[model samples]
Target: MPAVNSQPRRARSGNRRDEAARVAVLHAADDLLVEHGFGALTVEAIARRAGVAKQTIYRWWPSKVEILLDTLIEDTAKRLPVPTELPTASGIRAYLRDFADFLAADPAGKCLLTLLAEAQHDPGTAASFHERYLEPRRIAEIEMLTRATEAGEVSPVLGPEATMDALLGPIVYCALTGVAVPRDLVDTLAENILRPRA
Candidate 1:
């Protein structure tokens, strides 16, 4: 007789129940963060709101910060997707507008601010936030700029890093400072940074 395998089965990636629990946990974390702020956000609270065991939350995410990071990534991807079909300048403008709106909107905007604040004190959080969240978006924006340069739609005078800073800095500053992002900021940024080939 063959020896019985005594190890417990690991959850499959495509398991429906696992996916549902994941989504529930993410949603619960976002809702709780918005409702009670990060100070009150805990693994226990997330588990309760998600209707899952505390151990389940721990099984997937080690801590509340990880859960919030996941929530932020999902929300940013959904709300501020990069424009693919438009011309580079137009795409940048559209993206900037979306970004501004995202910073102003509830839940996601709040989530971003919360993470940024949390990152200030904890080196581990800061590193993970940069590596996991900010770097991907930065790379995507740089690719957009590269395409525009290759197409001769815009001058390549500004380096990719400078261009991103110019386009994103003001709106993010406004968001952090609690000031309203100007209505014409996107247009101004696009026109200036993505100046037409002359």
Candidate 2:
């Protein structure tokens, strides 16, 4: 039998430690952002809350915004289910309606709203949010819209980018402004955007 390498064992231990610390930092960031808002979130604060050194966070993320972005991704992944099996129109309406309900129910909503407001002034932060968070959701929407367009459920003239903007932009605006769009409104919005042309 071949002897086991000690280095590989040590590397595995290190990987586990790294994974644990990373999860701690992300959860700590989520809690801090939810409890105190973005203004109070900092690498130092996250490190303190996670009980990891600040250098550990900097080694992984470039900025506080990056950490917040990760938390947003985590939060959304756990809560949002963008189903591909349903008809595209139904999927989008159901997903956005569930999203609105999540916003009404989860503190992550407040954290996301605050992060977005901050992004308006910070180009780097905004770019990170766009790439890490918004782009994936946008990609999913585009795919859904493509399916809808192929099925003739949506107007052939209605482009994915424009249709999504027309459909979802108002919901985002309402979220930012503390107005809530109910599921029926979400259905109406999706119907309007996906309505077939003559």
Candidate 3:
């Protein structure tokens, strides 16, 4: 691993406080990303916004994109609920509907679409994003779908992974296109892809 000496090491007594500062920086970055979009955000801007040294931000994250990706994952995508109990047929529909609403309501949603587009032009960003964020979300959604299948809420013939893609693809597509996603479409996606067979 590479050394991280960009910032002076905090005393052991202050490690917890340092972590709090780091979180503050992340929060500032998240706000800047939502406010200005990625094109205008920078380490200096984030440091100023967070009231931290530039070196502190750099010590933790190598690039602005990395920080933005971290912020997005921490704030948005990971928070999406995959029910612990097997979701009922209606519960599953409600979950998807709620998810759509959440996505449409935040700049984090726009940030994700921006990241996806950036990934197309920047392979390193794409790889990091897939590993750090998207892959985990995919796995979690699949796991939730599996629970639904076991509960007889979803057809056994449709695998969880495929169902997840089929269900989420439209939302992603709309997000990318800046289109409004109707709640009705979200429910239809749940019924068409997740409903159990007769």
Candidate 4:
């Protein structure tokens, strides 16, 4: 399957005024999320910060959750882009290291963790998160893994879905538990995942 566009939907008219407002709102939401966190962020505060009316924000998004969702999408795309230039094993390792660092320090990481927590209570949020962010990334990774398998770089014992769960589950578990990710874990995962099954 082709990679999905994970960006939030926006007006397609290409009008400069609408574009400017959208940029301002996204930036404001990002700044507020980093400064005050999700628990403290508010739509009113975002409007005030962006110098736009609350109606302006509501025009594009239903609530602050949607705004944060958009910000998270943008940030993750820029922060954890898939590595296309390296060999598959190397690329996976590099991606894991980047993910570890993102969980440790990036504001986007905090946003994602917050969203995960919130999704537990909000079914709408859960569905949107899965459809808009997680699924697309999974599809992209699976595509990469398929290429590696075809090229004979790695012989995965499990199918693509299970293999991905095995590779990414540990890091995500560490993030959820607030445990520090071990420095060598990336290499260990790469070795195990890329090794041919006996």
Best by TM-score: 1
* Candidate 3: pairs in clash: none
Give the 10-residue window scoring lowest on summed lDDT in candidate 4: 82-91
Error of 3 at 126 (Å): 0.8
Task: Sort the predicted structures by lDDT, highest score first.
Answer: 1, 4, 3, 2
| Residue lDDT tens for model 4, 120-162 | 9999999999998889989988888888778777787788999
Cα-based lDDT for every prediction: 0.84, 0.76, 0.77, 0.82
Candidate 3 is scored at a TM of 0.84
lDDT of 4: 0.82
Cα misplacement distance, residue 76 of candidate 2 (Å): 1.9
Clash statistics: count for each candidate: 0, 0, 0, 0
Q: What is the overall TM-score of model 1 with all chains considered together? A: 0.86
Model 3 scores a C-alpha lDDT of 0.77
Clashing pairs in 4: none
Residues 80-195 of candidate 2 have per-residue lDDT tens digits of 75567635555666777877776666766766777779889988878878888888978887887788677766663467788878776777788887787764787677666677
Per-residue lDDT tens digits of candidate 1, residues 1-198? 999999998867542448888999999999999899999999999899999999878877778888989999998888777655535666677778888888888688889988999999999889999999989888888888888778887774579889889889999899989899988888777777778665
What candidate 4 gets wrong by more than 4 Å, as runs, is 1-17, 84-87, 196-198
Candidate 3 vs candidate 4: the lDDT winner is: 4
Task: List the candidates' TM-scores in order.
Answer: 0.86, 0.82, 0.84, 0.84
Question: Against the correct fold, how does model 2 do in TM-score?
Answer: 0.82
Steric clash pairs (candidate 2): none
